[model samples]
Target: MTGTALDAATTELLAGSLRELLASVSAGGELGPALDALGWAEVLADDPATATTLLFTEHGRALVSSRALDDVLLAELDPALPPAAGSRALLYPHPAEGADPAPLDGPLWGVLLGPLHGVDEVVVPATAEGRTVLVTVAATDLAAAGGPATGFDLGSTWHTVAGPRPPGSGPPAPEAWTRAVAAGRRALAAEMIGVCESALTLATAHTTDRVQYGRPIASFQAVRHRLAEAYVAVTAARAVLDAAWTAAGGADGGGWAAAAAKLQAGRAQAQVMRHAVQVCGAMGLSQESELHRHVTRAAALDALLGGHMALAESAGAALLAGADVHPVVEL
Candidate 1:
């Protein structure tokens, strides 16, 4: 099935299950067992006819689920895991400090960098002689030798994984890496859409209940306009993500589509979350409010896989290079 045609029932079921699983984990529960019980890893491991749909649905749900349960689930349910043969693999440029490189380490180290919270293992790519190889690294091994201490923040846990890598699959075509990065960009865009939606929901609910000057703040024309603007931005972001998701399934030049999707989604997420916080006023900034989490997470997501500006530049370069820039959604 195409990414756009993903069964709503199945999507809802997966979302609900993930939400419940994460809730249980957040309430002083073990994460690994919970995921294992839910067969999450197995589902990711299962080869699908349409990788785009699976990745988009699962990544989107994970983000939405994380909004309710917090960012702890971000790394645990990484859509990039369960590295498969012929699939795209992300390549890192350097090793984390204090971590030893693998025997086959090339000039560029294969690693996963950024807000890696609860991520046990990550897939890395290495290219040589026109072929790319995939490798997996465990988080524990990364920091085992006293590398940069793992740390957490309002948005996510920032950690760097490095060291010896376990061989994943045999080398694939060079283009496979590009495809994998594009798919990842699409998944990240999907997650950003969820973050924006969650922030908008919070802003809408807060304005509706908060009374100011004997009237609900939501009743004020200014507040209403702000919310309306945020809603439109979120909707636009979703549309871009949907188009990118569909394109990622099989469309030619999917990488360009994914880049555009990420650029637009990142902009929407940043704008919506900021407006959401402002609509909530001082309380939104308080630690007690969930709005802050959404804001911080959105900021972090926007920066992931290079920020919106970088993606925009990439897309522009591609267009200049004669890549077709057609609308994925036809009116």
Candidate 2:
């Protein structure tokens, strides 16, 4: 799902441009047209790793959600499939579900979760009886079947649909779905990193500005300790994720690599959120603060593809089963 390497300077430029664009879009702008005007499709064709990292990281920073994930998942699933004519969304597997859960499960999450805001149609990939079924369903139809769920995450552009799979079905090429899952896992991991990092940044700013007892909370050792730990968690997450990116691009058994990335990112998300909220106290829990957005978004993203505990347990099982353990970061 992730490949192509750009020189450092080029990557930096790309990151800058992406940040500017995403920041604008996050403020108030249309996602598809803005990305098209910026030639996002071309950039994706050139370097997927750069595209996923820069764009999704900004998505985390600005709390912007876009259908850009469709590009990542669909490209790996079936590149030959042409883009849809109308606005569309791709529903993916939810966090609670297993690798291949029931097709009609209530929570119809997506490969790239969120950014499912305005699309009228959706591409749902359902697995059953060892066959992969790709169905394009009307979003309105899903709504008619009970619409989206207003769950814990009110800030994210998450649409939880529940419905039946349309008529036709057949399995795709071998390992196609597996590859798609790996790609989605890595992409979500990038976004989670952005969310946790932004949360930490927000916490730091708040602690520095909010004063109590004639001093800023940030100056206190207790607050400083929490923020410091959050930083370390974020840094550790990014390190493992970079290796996953490398494994996905060139090395074999990227499944484990991607899993590792998501696992660490999930753990980091919880750590960052816990300390960030604690440092900000009651204000962090308030909807007025930006921390809650990251909090809820991280919750949903962590569950998508795989959660920290789920992946760790699975990783342990794989090791015990004698599966090839690709600790891409191996010494």
Candidate 3:
């Protein structure tokens, strides 16, 4: 096969693997172990960037990998989660006491909040300055230290693994942190594409099965038009994501592409999920039905790290301030 064909085949294989991994996780399998058994951990360790792209090919896979990335990059935690190893962890630039805390999913090993700079206590409205430090504390330690409470209702249990900052650890480089955050937004865009596609599939299936006036609902012109529109939106979003992924390899325009991709993907996911529910009627909201999972996951992702509108505004402001602009499709 030609190089392009080989790349296409590899992407297809990775998508299939991610789909199976999602199904397994839905069937009560542990995500970390499943990823390891599938050799994804080795892939991540070997080629972190490619592994990120593969993981983002599916919503469940992306969700697991994104959470794991926090530990792998920020805290230097073990990915295998061995008996001696701690559970998956989350890291955020800690907000001030009484200020709203950032939302998180899954158990946290501890919370690292700061620009410490040799301070003994966390100050309100922390900012990065000279000799910045990150103060770490377990979830329980928050209560003992009188720190502000932080939690998220992502339908998972988050436990405290340890307490206060590790010795000899300092703040991460500003560029590294910025790259990690950008990569996370791109991963979210990929997950949005997966969710939108899944919803479109469910909608298509339901319309084909449901009969109205002696004909399948999908046979109707209006139904077909709506579905066609959704398909277009999904296609556009996917193209944008692919472009962004490619652009990310370049040093100059990657952030701009990622932001644009995220904005478009978020909008596509919202529209697709809404249309899917409408097509499925009351059945879509039923707890026993699989459609709800896609909708719920889309909703959760939409709220993460600022939604589409926020991303658009940020991108717009950056562009206005002399940031480079690039076309989504180059002739």
Candidate 4:
């Protein structure tokens, strides 16, 4: 086989792995052990001396261990609450002399977090084996500790759950999770491609079946143009995603390529979903119809990694500054 063939094969394998890993994350399975076995864990794990770049909110804060550097004693607790009448309000509740923890349990976590993030909400269960905890870390406090008040390191917190040693035994190397995430993103982007195509197909089918004054609606110039645009957008998005996936297979420059893929895919997915909704008109928005479900899933997945515009801007800036814009994997 040639070099290009080898690269394509590697990408296919990585994409498959990514799809499976995403299914696992959604199914609530841990990947730490699997990653540790890959021999790349040390490279992926957090370095206390050097901070890592991450996609967290501007006012992010972390809850560190009070007992140990890795313990869950000090958690980053954000009390997500509903929007108050006539204004936005943040309920930063301090523990009363005898505050009960029961009120903290249940759907309230999700309820409070929903409005803050402006995305589909979820409440990670608080089970013994391992669960997400809420910690209240003040910006001032964090600043006083000699660091910016912006990003956080969740990997640091993972140490507490598994103790000084990392979790898992003989398994894939640590870098596996990074590769897995990249691959997973690519697969999801591919699924979005499938979704856009299906939506266009549905619209075309409807136009063909529904008659206007004297002929099929598909004969209308406006309908034809709309479908043509949808086709272009979906196809372009798919191409970017495929190229990004191929780039992600190599160890050299996968990060930038993955970013580009994510950015392009997200915008394309959103545009395609909106176009689908417009083409279907009232029927598309119906709760009973499967079209809306596909649209919703596409919109949701777009933000699964990060904002498309931001990624695009970053990619553009890097390019303008003469940074390497080529795909990392040599194919």
Best by lDDT: 2
Residue 236, candidate 2: Cα error in Å is: 0.9
Question: Per-residue lDDT for 1-331 in model 1, tens only?
Answer: 3224335676567667766664454422234566668775545444222233343444333343222222222232233335433212123433221112223444334334343345454455555454544445454444442233233234343334444444444434345445655655666676777777777778888999999899999999888898899888878876786677556555443778877888888888778877888889999989899876777666666665657877777678888998766657765
Candidate 2 Cα outliers beyond 4 Å, as residue runs: 1-4, 26-30, 79-88, 104-121, 136-143, 250-253, 327-331
| Ranking of candidates on TM-score, top first | 2, 3, 1, 4
Give the winner by TM-score: 1 or 2: 2
Task: Please tell me which model should have the higher lDDT, number 1 or number 3.
Answer: 1
- Tens digits of per-residue lDDT, candidate 2, 1-331, equal 4346677898788778777788776522356687788788777777777677777877777777655666667667654234565776666665567455345333354343443347666667776555666656666656543334357777555555554544544344336666777787788888999999889889999999999999999999999999999999989888888888778753333787788888999999999999999999888888889888889889877887778899999977877888655556545
- lDDT of model 4 at position 177: 29
Better of 2 and 4 by lDDT: 2
State the C-alpha lDDT per candidate: 0.57, 0.73, 0.56, 0.41
Predicted candidate 4 versus true structure: per-residue lDDT over 1-331, tens digit per residue: 1122224454345335433443343111233344344332332233211101110100011111111110011111112322222212111111121111112232121111112222122212221222222223222222221221112221111110101211112222224323433543454455556556666777788778878798987788777777888888877776776567456536632556666666766777677667667767677778665676566545544544445765677668877888555543463
Clashing pairs in 3: 107-158, 107-159, 116-133
Please provide, for model 3 over 225-256, each residue's C-alpha lDDT reduced to its tens digit, 9 standing for 90 to 100.
88898999888887887777666655542778
The local lDDT score (0 to 100) that residue 279 gets in candidate 4 is 66
Q: By TM-score, how accurate is candidate 1?
A: 0.69
Off by over 4 Å in 1: 2-6, 26-122, 126-141, 145-152, 162-173, 251-253
TM-score of each: 0.69, 0.85, 0.70, 0.48
RMSD of 4: 16.5
Positional deviation of residue 253's Cα in model 1 after best superposition, in angstroms: 7.2
Superposed Cα deviation of residue 244, candidate 4 (Å):
1.8
Show where candidate 3 strays beyond 4 Å: 1-6, 26-30, 41-50, 61-66, 69-88, 92-126, 129-169, 250-253, 326-331
Lowest summed lDDT window (length 10), candidate 2: 104-113
